[model samples]
Structure formats: C-alpha cells, structure tokens
Target chain A: MKNNIVEKIWQQHVVHRQAGFPDVLRIDFALLHEVTSAQAFAMIERKNLSVQNPEHFLATIDHSIPTRKNRHEIYDKTAKNQIELLRKNCQNHGIPLCDLDSSHQGIVHVVGPELGITQPGMTLVCGDSHTATHGAFGSLAFGIGTSTLAHVFAAGAILMKQPKVMRVHFNGQLPANTYAKDMIMYLIAQIGIGGATGHVIEYTGEAVTALSMEQRMTLCNMSIECGAIAGLVAPDETTFAYIKDRPYAPKGQQWETAKSYWQSLSSDAGCRYDQTIELDITDLQPQVSWGTNPEQSIAINQVIPFSNKTKESLDYVKLKSAQSIAGLTIDWAFVGSCTNGRIEDLRVVADILAGHKIAKQVTMYIVPGSEQVMHQAQKEGLDTIFTEAGAEFRMPGCSMCLGMNDDKVPPGSRCISSTNRNFIGRQGTGSITHLASPATVAFSALAGFITSSYAEQQPQKEAS
Target chain B: MNTAIKQIKGLCAPMMIDDIDTDIIIPAQYLTQTSKDGYGQYAFSRLKQADADFVLNQQKYQTAKILIAGDNFGCGSSREHAVWAIQELGFQAIIAPSFADIFSNNARKNGLVLIDQPLEICELLAAAAQQNDLIISIDLVNAVFKTDQQTFPFVINPFFQHCITEGQDELDYLCSHLSEIKAHHQNAKGQTIFLAGAGVAQ
Candidate 1:
C-alpha cells in the first residue's frame, strides 16, 4: 500500500498496535537537557530502572546553566542542583554527557544535527518542544514529558496516537531579507496558534526546498509555536549533503546505503494527506510579531490590527493598535535561541554590523545556539565585528530565551528578539517581546527601534 | 500515577481564558526544582496575579477537583509540570473546548483525565465559575459529563481511558508487552543494519 513518509515512518517504528489505542512506537534516540531531566532521572532511580539503551541516550546542560563568563559553578541554587543532578544521573547511568566544557555541548537540538546525531528515518524524543527541529531531516522527532522520559529510559519506546498529516506547500520565491523565520512567522499568522492542533505538518514546494538545512531547522523548530506535533521536510540531496562527514553520521559504504534509504523516505506520489495548504511566499515580506502570540504577526511595514485578542495583547505589550510596528523604540535586541542562533544567523547579523555600529541606546546580544556555532563564528571573526560594533557576544545556551538564568530582559522593557514564543512575560516578567528574523533584529539594533533591513535608507551615525 | 479516576464530582474552577499556556500555569522559574511536589502553590501563579479573583485563588474554589477551561487550554510548552501542577493543585480532571497536543499527551501519561467538549458547552460550563451549587460530575467510563441541566458526551483515546479506569500507568502497560517489544526491536535491527563498504567519499 502506498503511503506518505509520515505513515511509513510510523509503520517502521510500531512495536505494538491495537485498535482505538495509541501504537507503541520504538524510539531510536532520546535527548535530555538539564532543566527537564532531573525529575525523570530521579524517577528512574526510585523505580530501579537502568537506562535500557545507554548508548542511545545523550545528555546535555543548556537551559539552567548561566551563559556568563564563568568557567564553572552556577550561582542559583536551583539551577546548580539541576545541573549537578544531570551530571550525576548521566554518570550513574553510563549515558554520554555533553558537559559544560565539551566542544559538542550546546542546545540539544542545535548540537544534534551539527554532530550528525540526528538522522533521517529515526524516532527521537527530547524533553523540549523544539525537538521538532530534527524533523527537518525527515525524522519523526517531538518533545515528551518527564513521565514519558522516564518510560523511555526504562523501555526505549513510547505509546503515541498517530497524528493526522497536513502538507503545507510553500510556492514561489521568498523575497530578499525574508528568511525561513519570516516564512514560518508568516505561516503562523495565516493559521492561528491553534490552527495546526493534532497534526504533523510536512512543509513542501519550491520555497521550502530552497531553504538551507540550517534554515529548514529554523522552520521546523517553531512548529511547536503553531501547536503542531511536528514539522517535517522530506530529505533530499541538500539534506544528505548536510549529513555527510558529520561526527556521528554513518561513514563510507554505510553512508551510501543510508543515503539510498533516506532518498526513499519521501512521500510517494498520489499519496493522500488529511489536509493540504497552498502558501505563496513570492509576495511574502519580512514578518514581525506585534502582539503577545506568534499569530499576531504582520509584515514589517504593517500596523497592528484590531483582532479579537489585539486589545488584550496591546494592554499587555503596551503597544497601541493601528500603530505602525516600524520605528517602535526597543530597549534591547536579542539574536539567539533554538530558533535563530545558528552560525548562518550569526553570519547575517555580523555582515550587517561589520562596519556599522549599533544605536547607543539599544543593548544588543548575539548568542550562538551551540558551542560549535560559537567556535565557527569566532573562526570567521564574526565575534570581532559584533564586539567592535558594541554588541555583546555571549556564550552558547538558551540565554534570555526564557530568562531562566541571570540573563533577562528587564521589566517594563521592550526587546526585539529572534527567539520563538513571544507570549506575555515570556522573556521576563513585564517584559514585552517583538519576534523577528535575524536580519530584522540586526537592523533594529542598528536603528535602536523595530525596523526592517529592506526599509528605505536613512543617514546613519556611528555609536558615540 | 496509578490512581484511578473513573469519576470526579466537584465544583468546577473555571479558567475562562483561551490558550492558557503552560507558562502561565507555572512560570519557567519554578520549573528548575527537581521535585514535582510543592507545585500546587505555583499553579496559575501568573494568571492569579493578573486577576486576583481567579477561581483557583478564591477560597470557594480551593478544593475543586474539576477544571473548566476555554479553547486551546494547556497550550504551549511540552512540560509535564503544567499537568503536575494541576494535579498537585487538586484537579483530577480538566474539561476544555480543546487542548494542545503535547499537553494533552502529558495529562494522559500522568493519569490526569482531560475531556474535550464542544466550545459552546465549555463556555457554558466556564460561565458557572465561582458559583456555589454548580457541582459537575464526570463519568470517565461513559465519556460523559453531567450537570443539573444536561449531560454532554466527549471523546477520550481508548488507551488513556483504560489506563485511567484501571488505575494503571502507561509504562506499566508497556512493560507488560516487554517481550513483544524486544522481539520487534530485534527484527528492526536485523533489517536496517548495513555494513561499511569500500573506500567511499570521505
């Protein structure tokens, strides 16, 4: 029987299935991070269950660790304990640890693909919503709760209801300065935050295919923002090229076999999907969020519309409706997260700020997603240009993304961020967040306000 | 995790807001604690602050075991903390117009019953917030909720329904099928393993 790639993957991983019940699906890999794993590890100990597949388990410290200039030691007791718990748990269970100083350490999602640990046709679960980033490789990856994490630790599988498949075809060319971030931000606006509920989206068409692997990751990483279980792009030559010669990827002749299998992992022609959406990105402009939720976004030059939630969102964000989002003053500009902290995102910002200095009033931060990305940016001297332009080049972690650590957007401040999720008080209590692409964030930092890279040029002055 | 929830009859603590994300249920700051206990105090902390008269904070709704929420309840974040918080705060079940995918899954794993009803019904139930003598009864076995006026039918994934009624954890059920799972794993391994070939692109 012919089926789409999602159905084929489901069939490959089903260990047990009964009518009206979720299929017991086998997991190929389990990724763990600091904040969400401690309780799961403790549960495992209480139940006396060893990690069944130690080799398949990978642990890292990201969420709780301070991204400041410290060699070691977390000041916050809660964060310190969580990190310590993760290290202890990984050591006790013989699981591989991507410790703080490990070159491979970074956000779990970022490090996974860069190290070739994330591959096509595999089922991966992390205790994070952004785990959908792995779906960019044509794999079935999504976040699981701590209870499911403990279950996976004990049995290497999870029971899941098969999600209905939705295919979103992004037709036509994406205009300049509009990136994967814009494409997805625009998509979420088209469909409200709950539009894709109970479905897995397979992004297709010319615009999707044109995005680089890193860009594709950015696209899929925000699938959770739209309430989708996962977002996937079928593996192609570009996917294979990105996987080649990575640290954990199969090597030599095994590579050929693997590539052949990956090539076969696309949707068969004439296969049916539960829903199909046609989106034209040719006329798409750079998107920017005006309100609290991601769906409240509009094109950069547009004004905030009075939607059902607009009044409440405006009261929370302290922005007036019908006012142009452009030229709205911002206190800070952040360029990082599992969303847009890749090396490519850094390079774009660096290229923009190479000669121009940031506005004196705006405090800008360029946080790389992973240690490898940080190192790569430094090797390319992108760090020098950023620092010379007066932007802070911080270490890798989920800093300021949720402000779990010391890095936080001050209360009553407005920040233009490249991170996903602009929910009310997401960055900090009483902090308003405006979500945008890296290009827009960089330009906003340069202008000290919410502006676009494609806006008309004005006389610029160097920072005092 | 094994507590059976075949039925829950109590006053409904109505959170009428739509898209009550996990972040609002329990903020990120409180998630750092390794222990799942003590989360009840933080349940809906932000929302409670926003609206001081939030039903969860009202003394009248303190012991409520059922929650009536608006559309897309438990939206945002894959954290089980939201479910843990709700469970700790004394909610045995949540009735909503809809729920986010991950949050709904987390609720099932934790054996917290989540019933999805039509939006109109949810709104009707939510309208009875903080009012005395508005007891609601949920019958998990029949997948129906009963009020003084009417009974509304809802849907639950049969597997979760079985677990809830049997007082069984999902892991326990999965463990019962261990041998079958192991055999399937062996078969999958045998089929997918490929030998490293001669010198290929390095």
Candidate 2:
C-alpha cells in the first residue's frame, strides 16, 4: 500500500484490531502535564495498575506552574496540590519527570523537543492538545483526554480509529516579515476554525519544508486551533539534525539505525489524501487576530472584516467594522507559549527592542519556552535587552498563555499576545487579546498599539 | 446491530454555536480542581453570565439531557473537564454537525455520546427545542435519532457505539489485557519508540 506518514505509523503501531472496533494502537510515548493528569493518575490507582512501561512516559508540570522565578512558592493551594500530586505520582510509577527544579523542566511540548524525546515515526500522545507540536519530527502525535491517558498508563495503548488525511500545501516563498506563525494564522483565518475537523492535517510543500524545526513546531503547535487534534510534517534532514546528540537521543550505532528507519517514514509518491488545501503565502503579510477565535483574524495591513458571523466577536473585542486595528493602544504584550517561545522568537523581540524603549504605558512580558531556552536567551543577552526596554523577562513556563497562573491580563485591558487562542476571557476575565507574531507583539508593545514591524517609519536598529 | 445499546431517550437543549471550546465549556480557572467533580456547576459560566437566558440556563432545559450545537463543538484544548461538565449537567449525548477529535474522544471515553448530524438536521432539532419537553431518543444499535416529527439517521464509530451501549469504563478493557501488551513490547525491535536520544534497545 502506498501509505502516507500517518497510515504507515498507524499500521505499524496496531497492537490489535477487530472487525468493528477501533484499532488498539500502541503509544510509543506519553507526555503528561499537571492540569489534565491528576484525575488520570487517580483512575490508574483505582484500577490497581502501575505504569506498564515506565520508560515510555514523561511527566512535567507546565499548565499549572506559575512562570515566576520563585515558582516553588506556588500561591494557589489547588495548583500547589496538583503540582505536588504529579511529583508524587511520578515517584510512584518510576516514570521520569522533569520537576520544576530540573533544568529540563519547561512546557511539555518544548521540553519534549529540546531533550530529544520527540522523534520521527512514533505514535506519541499527550494529555495536552498542542502535543501536535511533536509531529514536526514525522511522528504520529496527538492530544489525549484524561481517560485515554489512564488507558496509556495501564496498557501503553488505546483504541484509536484512523483519521482521514488532509494535505495542506503551502506553496510559495514566504515574504519578508512573515513567519511560520503568520502562515498558520493565515490558513486558520482562511479556513474557518473548524475547517479540518476530524482529519489529521499533513502540512507539505516548499514553504513548509523550508521552515526550521523550531518554526515547524510553531506551525504545527496550533493544529488544534483549527479543530485538528494532530498535524504531521514528513521528516527531512532538518528534523534529523535537530534530534541528533540531544540528551535522550539514541547513541552511536543506535543513532545510525534510527536515522535510516526515519528516512523511510515519509509519504509515498502519489499517496492519497481525503481532502487537500492550498495556500500561496508569497503575498501574505504579518497577520493578527482581532477577535475571539483564531478564525477571526486578518492581515496586519487590513482592517477588521465585520459580518454577521463576526458581530459577536466584534462586540467582545470592542472592535468595529472597517476600522484600522493599528495604533489602537494595547496595555500589555506577551511573547511566549509552545507556539513561539523559542530562542529565535526572543531574538526577534530583542532585535527590535535593542535601542528602543517600550511605550511608557505598555507592559510587555517575555517568557522562554524552557529552561534551556531561558539559558540560551541569557547567553545571547536577550534578557538584558528585554528588561532594559521595560519588558519583564520571567522564568520558563506557560505564563499568561491561558491565565491559569498569577500572570493575568487585568480585566477589561487590551493586550497583544504571541500565544495561541484569543478565546474570550482567555487572558483574564474581560481581558481582550490581539493574537500576533512575536515580532508584531514586540513592535506593538513599543508603540502601545496594534502595529507591525513591517510598517515603514518604525524604529529600526541598524545591523552591527 | 441490536446489541447492548437499545435506545437513549432524553430532553434536548440547543447550543447552536461553532467552536464551543473547552475554555468556554469550563474556564481555565476551574481547571485547578484536581478531581473531576464540581465542574458541572461552572459549565458555560461565561456565556451564562453574558445573558441571563442562555439556552442551558433556560427553565425548559433545566432537565435537558441532550445538547444540539453547531459545527466544531468542543474545538480547543484537550481538557476532559468539558466533557465531565456536560455529563454532570445531565447530558447523555451532544448532536452536532461535527466535533473536534480530542473532545469527541474524551466524551466517548466518559460515556457521553456525540452524534454527528448535518446542519439542517441540527437546526430542525434546535428549533423544535423552543417548545417545552422536546424529548429525543437515539437508537445507537440502528444509528438513528427519533424526535416528535422526524427520524434522522446518524453515523457513529463502532468503538464509541460500544462504549455508550455497554456503559462500562474503558479502563477495564485496557487493564484486563495488560499482560499481552507488555509481552509484545519486549520484542518490539527496529522501532525507535524510546524518546530523547534515550535507549533504542541497541
């Protein structure tokens, strides 16, 4: 059979199959976080089953962990208990956990890639939907619910029916100032948020292949935003180079055998897909979401496109039809999350903030995705540039992305964020979030408005 | 097809909006609850606050056991709290044109049915929900939904069908056969299942 990457991995991992039942698929690895895993652990305990394969499970505290330097002093009693519960559960099962004190501790998706846990040709599952981030390495990865998590803990497999394949081909040389973030935002805005419902999106084409591993991770991270639980990118040399020599990567001879196996995991020529989508982003510019859902977004240069469908979003975002979104005064800017919190995203922000000061009224928060990213940013002096420009460079975690922690956009404030999802009250109750790229959020923080660096007359630091 | 699932009869409510995300279903603040129980009280908190007469809050659906929504129901975040909330709120199944995969899986695992019907069918079921006591019965064995006036056919994955009909936790299904899965893993050669440059069983 000329199978695509998803089919190949699905077939290889089928532990058992029946005539009418879903395939009992083997999960090669599972990632867990604090929020969704507590109940899952309780389920396993009720069933009297320890983790069947301890080596295959990795746990980390991200969603509920406060992104402050003194993260150990968690203030929320419930959040504190959940964090402690994860620590206790990991110890009980002997599963490896990247505790808050560990350098490897960070966002599960970010740490999974950084420590080389995510690899090609495996079926990886996490309790968090952004688990799609690992699919950038050619793995068949998706988010699971707490019940599914318990299933994995007990048997290392779960019943999974195959998802129909949707090939999203991004054909074009991406224009300057546009990024993988913009590419994905454009696709979501073009196709409504539910466009890819029930299908695994396979992002392919020249533009997609050209993205760095980090960038591909960023693009794939938002697959869930458009209702796809998983997304995949066929592995290439870029993927192998990124995975090589990392802490948990295979050693010496095992590396050679692993690479060869990965090489054969790509989609076959003329492989069939249930649906196909094409986007030419050559003319695409930096994009921004002015409304609640990711679909309520448009090019930075364009005004909010108001309509019957958008009336609800417009009322919530306090935006009007045909009004320019630029220079609309933002109270805060956040540049973090599994989506765009890598070293490269920080460098973009630092470059723009080198000699400029953030607007006196604007509050900018910069968070690294992981401790490794935190160290790398400090090594590059990006931390200095950020604080010097009046931005808060906090410790690594999913800080203001979902407002689970203490870092929240005050009620009724407007902020431009680099994180995914602008759901109503996501940042904080009554807080309005304008979703944009890190560069756009950084530049907007400097101007205290919804502006982009691509706009002329913006302050620019000359190349050294 | 007449198996464990005979028929599911319940009063239905209409929540006809797209992208009813987990965040909206149960906000992130409620996520801190380590256990899965109390989220029922806080389901759709934001929308209920926005308007006093949100559909779920209306007196007619006070005992509603079904939800009919637009496309992409439960679209964002993988928090099972959303499913737990709906289940706790006395919903047996949600009828929508489509559903996000994670939410669908979570619902099925928790024994909450998600019936995929086209928009016109959902709209008909929704409009019919205005009058009091709009009871609908789902025949999972035959894969069809029957209402006061219309009988509409639906499609369901056989796995989800079995979960609802059998009404048993999937944990039993997974744990009973654990020995076999572990035995199979030992000889799982040539596959790079070990993560992070970790042991590749070389």
For A1-464, candidate 1 gives per-residue lDDT tens digits of 77898998888889888898788888888889988888888887887777876777788788867777783768898888888888888889988888888897888899888878788888889999889999999998998889899988888888888889999899998898889999999989998889899899999998889889999999999988888999999999999899888777787777887888888889999999999988999889889998888888999878888766567788888877777788788889999999999999999999888888998888998888988999999999999999999999998999888888878899889899999988877888888899999999999999887788633544223212
Candidates 1 onward: DockQ, in order? 0.45, 0.55
lDDT for each residue of candidate 2 in A1-464, tens digit (9 for 90 to 100): 79898888888788777788777788888988888998988988986778877878888788877787788999999999988888898888887888877888889899888888888988899999899999899988999999899999988999878789889999888898788999999989988888888889999999989999989998999988887768989999999999998877877877888898899999999999999999998899999998999988889878877588878888888778887777677889999999999998999899988988998889899999988999999999999999999999998888899999988999889899999999999998888999999999998988877788633444322212
As a whole number from 0 to 100, the lDDT of residue A292 in candidate 2 is 95
Can you tell me the DockQ of model 1? 0.45
Worst 10 residues of 1 chain B by lDDT: B193-202
lDDT of 1: 0.85
- Residue A427 alpha-carbon offset, candidate 1, angstroms: 0.7
